[model samples]
Target: MIAWFRQHGRALAAAVAKVRAQPMTSALSALVIGIALALPAGGYALLSNLSGIAQRTSIEPQLSLFMSTEAKAAETEALGKRLRADPRLAAVRFVPRNEALAALRRTGALAEVFAALEHNPLPDAFVLRPRDAAPDALDALAGEYRRLPGIAHAQIDSDWARRLAALIRLARSGIFLLGALLGIGLVAVTFNTIRMQILTQREEIEVAKLLGATDGFIRRPFFYLGVVQGLAGSVVALSIVSLSLAVLDRAVQSLAATYDASFQLSHLAPADAAAVAALAGFLGWLGACLSVSIYLRQIEPS
Candidate 1:
């Protein structure tokens, strides 16, 4: 392992030096990779932060139970009893039609309609909350509760929760797709770069093959070259992403402050950042390897 490290270290240094010799080309290529990578990387980071924000945001599990106009008072109370007695349910409240009528009267905007009605058409209903916080379980329970006797309907109280979860899922899929495209682009960039390098060093590969060097040995330096390029690009990409997130976090904090919200901005954790860098490095190595292997096969030693 020590010998291998020494060998790789020497190869990495040579690759870095070679890249430095062509500053303009290196800059342009790295920038291309960085920009391509940044979009999806930043998107995933934003989603990560937003998900954390969602968890921190409090949501009251309010279930609305609507009754049919044919429903009577004793039945509503009995329904509330069954829901409240269930182990899965955390809370329940009965909303009588009289109380609902009073509430509308207090609003004043509906006073004329309330006064014109010969009889209250509103049915008595119960509001129920599930003890468990899982949205799927909540939905299932709502479905079951609606099928219960004398209960006309049961539904989630907040449309926002459902909508937000859907939005997150959509964003996640989009980010995944975007990341895949970018990865392919990275490989293309690395492949083209290695191809150019191969052309420049054609004589060296021919001479090495004639000297009895195995394809594996001949491929080592180029693989290292690719790894270096990838590692450098990853560093640059991650830096851009982190800086962008920092700016976004500050903006969010400022906006939250304007609304007097207690919400805080989230930073990308260490493990995630490391994973991003490692992924970039692997992609770079793979891209380089593909190009070198294909070209090496075609080179005829004269």
Candidate 2:
């Protein structure tokens, strides 16, 4: 037990000392990893904000049900009542043809034309609010409403809403894929760096082998070296991510205040922050292992 403890103590001390000796180089490498990680994390934040907007728009979605020109007011009122009574309905608004025509005139641009018209050409319409009006739910409800006996046509109020939601989803996926590619770059960078370090120590490794050191004994230090690099890189990455978010949040909040919005943009939730750190560290560690394993085998210096 004493021998094992002494050997491990020496190895750890050496690895740590090596890092301390090259503070500038180590710091630069960590900063590089941090920058790479921050790009993806920022992209993800943009996606989250867009998603929130899309969700807010989807709430209380309504289907517009227009009646035929000859449809009676009683028929429209009855339809409104029936819609309100349905379990799937939230609220129903009835617009008479004359009231709809008046609304058009109030928009000001159509005032002259609306005055010239002899009859109210606008049809009676029902504005429907559904209980669950997410894109898919609204679509299904619109399909059912279009088939109703008295309804001339049922139209989804926000056709563009669904498209926006789809676009946001696509953007989010793209960001995630981009993050993955950047992570690969990080691993590549770390691996190359470790491989170079191993080659630099070839003479010392050969001397140890001549002294009857086993493969495990030589390999253990390189493994420890990888862990150090990975941990350092993670610390750097985390700092970058946090600092970038802090800067961005201030900018976003400033813009939001102009619009009188109660917007407080969120950062990476706890789970996501942990995931970012863990992923960065794991990649760093894996990169070191790959580099060390390949070169360690190439050096049969004994």
Candidate 3:
């Protein structure tokens, strides 16, 4: 095990030295890989943040069942029970006229306005959350609620939620497609890079073969080189994405504060970062394996 570790360590060092020997080319190639990776990675990060914002900002459409002003408290309770029993509803909350008025009074600006009223004019109401948030389901439930005997108004406040959900879904599909394309591009980039390295060291490879070195031994340095390049690119991509998110977070926070909102941007999670690094390394290793298999076959002991 120690001997194996020593051999691998020497190959890793040799790979580093080769990259150091052509600093400009290596840096340029890694930069290209990083940019290609950053596009999709950055998109994924933005989409995740957008999804979080949408979830926080998008208010669930609630069915407000305002009863007729003459309706009694017993009637409201009966209706509330029926609404709760329905399979379509997740919850039903009854708000008495007095309670609703008190809630309005809690708002500092509206407290004095509500206090000036001669009497409590607000009607008893029921706020409902549906089990299914789909637009069609909400519309159907709203119609049913409106037809109830004492229900003076049944309003569904969900148009924005529906539109936002659809937009997020469409955006997610687009991001997925973009990521797939960029992933293929990354693999191709690594493949071409490895191919060039193989060509450059063709004579050395032949000499190694003549010295009784196995193909595995000859391929070790290139594998290390590819993996190192991939990891380096991943680091660059992560840096660019994090900096962008930081800048955007500041802007988002400033805008949110203007509306008295407590919104904050989310950063990439640790698991996601790990996945990105693993993906890059795996793709690099795959590209190197493909190139090595092709070129090594062509360079025999002859």
Candidate 4:
């Protein structure tokens, strides 16, 4: 175990040395990988922020059951109890006609119009939050409630939520497609970088082979090099994302203030950032393994 550790340490040191030897090349390669990764990662961050805003803004699909004006208080209470008992509903809150009317009166714009009315035109209502936010499920629940006794109307103001959900899905698909293409490009970049390194050290590799060095020994440093480059690139990518979010959040904050809303873009969580780094490292390792396997065989000692 000690020997294994020592060998790995030596290989890692050598990889670091090589990268330092060609600072400009390594930095440029890392920059390329960072930019590619940032595109998809930024999109993901944007989607996450939007989803957060939806949740914070209470975009949950809600069904409002307006009771018939003729419905007695007893009947309204019974309907509220029935709705509360339903397992599919997350919550059910009853709003009495009087309370609804008072709320309307409190609103500056509607107070004048409502004050002139002789009788309260507003009906008793139960605001329902369904456990399932799926469009079909919401529609089904709304249809079911509409048929209930004393329910004059079952209105769902979930069209905006549905549209937002659809848009998020489409955006996720686009991000995935973009990430996949960029991932392939990253692999190609590493492959070419490793190929060039192998070509540059052809004579050295042949000498090591003649000295009876095992393939694993010759491959170790290159593998470490690839992993290092990938990790560095991920650092660059995260930095770019952080900086961009900071800039965008300022503008978003100013815009949100106009509407008297509090919102800010969230940074990637620790787990998510770690996953990105792991994925980048794997891509780099894969590219290095492929390049070394193919080119190393061609340079066998004569």
Candidate 5:
């Protein structure tokens, strides 16, 4: 046990010392990994916030059911009562023509224009809130409303929100593809870095082999070295991602406030952050293993 501990401890110390010796090279390699990782992390963060907005918009999706010009107040009231009684609907609010006109007048720019109109141009409308807010379900509900009595037209106010949700989903798939490609690049970079280190220590490796040192003994330090490099790179990547999110969150809050929306940007979940760090370290370790396997075989005590 003591011998095993001493040997492993020496390998770990050697690996750390080697990194300390070449801080610039180590940092630059880590920076490269960091940039590659940050692209996906940052994109995922943005997508998460957008998804939240989409969900809120979906849950409260409002359908505007406009009554026909000739529709009477009794028919409008009956339609409202009918919609309110539906099992699938959460709530329904009836907006009379006069109220609609009043709202138009409240808009500063359109107030004078609305005041000059001879007759109220707007028809009575019902603002609908559905119990189920799924896009397909909402569309189906809208279609049913259009066929109802006195409903001249039915339009969902959250159509843009549905589209936004779809776009965010598509963007997430694209980000995954891009992340896969970048992960390969990360592996390649680590592989080459390990290969170069192996070549530089060729003489020392040959001497160790001649002294009857096993392959595992020679490989330990390089393995440790790769892990260290990967961890350093992940630290840099996390820092960049965190800082970017901090800045973006502030900007998003300010923008949301302008529209009187209670929106806030979200950060990566704990599991996701851990996954990022784990993936980085795994890639580095795997790259080192591959390089060492190929190159170490070529330097056999010659």
Candidate 6:
């Protein structure tokens, strides 16, 4: 076991030496991979932030149950209790007629219009937040509520939620497609890079083969080199994403301030960042393996 580890350590050392040997080439290759990765990563981060903002800004499907003018207080009270007991509802709040009128008056533009009213024209209502936000679920709940004894009308403003949900779904699909394409590009980049390295060390590999070096021995250093490149690329990608988010957050904060709102772009979570790095490293290793397998066969000592 110790010998295995020692062999790998030596291979890793050689890989590092190769990377350091051509600093400019390594940096440029990393930069290309980083930029490619950042495109999808940035989109994912933006989508996440938008989804959070939607949640914070009341995107959940809501139903308003307005009482009939003739609905007795007792009947209204019973209906409220029933609604509160329903498992489908996340929350239920009863708004009295007078309280609703008072709220209308609180709105600056509507204040004068409401003040001229002889009596409260608004009906007592129950504002409901449904646990399920699916369009069908919302529609079913609205239908059920409208059938209740005291419910004069069941009005739901779930169109926005539906639209937002659809938009998010589409955006997520787009990001997934984009990421897939970029991932293929990333692999190609690594493949070509490893191919070049193999070409550069063709004579060395041939000599190693003639000296009775096993294929595994010949492959180890190149494998490690690919992993190193991938890891470096991931680091560059993370840095690009972080710096971009920082700049975007500054602009977003400024815009939000105009609306008296507070919002900031969030960076990729630690787990997500780690996953990116791992995936990058794996792609690199795969590319190197492919290059070595194909090219090394062609380099047998004559």
Across 86-128, the per-residue lDDT of candidate 5 in tens digits comes to 9898888888889999998987656778999999989999898
Write out the backbone clash pairs for model 4: none
RMSD to the native, candidate 5?
A: 4.0
Ranked candidates (lDDT, high to low): 4, 6, 5, 3, 1, 2
Off by over 4 Å in 2: 1-9, 52-61, 66-75, 82-155, 158-161
The pairs that clash in candidate 5 are: none
TM-score of 5: 0.80
Question: Which residue segments of model 6 deviate by more than 4 Å?
Answer: 54-60, 65-92, 97-124, 128-154, 299-302
- TM match of model 6 to true structure: 0.76
Task: Name the runs in model 1 displaced over 4 angstroms.
Answer: 1-6, 57-61, 65-90, 93-127, 130-155, 300-302
**Could you give candidate 4's per-residue lDDT for residues 42-154 as a string of tens digits?**
88989988877566556778999999999988888888888889999999988889999999898766688999999999999999999998888999999999998898999
lDDT of 1 by residue, 1-302 (tens): 99778877777777887788888888877888888888888898888877876666545677888888777677777776777789987888888878988887766556787989988877776777778768888889888888877777787885576567668889999999999999999989988998898889889888988899778767777887787777778778888898898888788888877655655555567897787778777888899899999987787554
Cα shift from native, residue 13, model 1 (Å): 2.6
State residue 282's C-alpha deviation in candidate 6, in Å: 0.9
Q: Put down candidate 6 lDDT per residue, 39-72, tens digits, no spaces.
A: 8888888888888866766666789999998899
User: Candidate 4: global Cα-lDDT?
Assistant: 0.88
Q: What is the lDDT of residue 244 in candidate 3?
A: 86
Per-residue CA lDDT of model 2 for 208-236, tens digit only, reads 88898877677666666666776677666
TM-score of decoy 2: 0.71
Write down the TM-score for model 3.
0.79
Tell me each candidate's TM-score: 0.72, 0.71, 0.79, 0.77, 0.80, 0.76
What lDDT does each candidate get? Answer: 0.81, 0.78, 0.83, 0.88, 0.85, 0.88
Q: Pick the TM-score winner.
A: 5
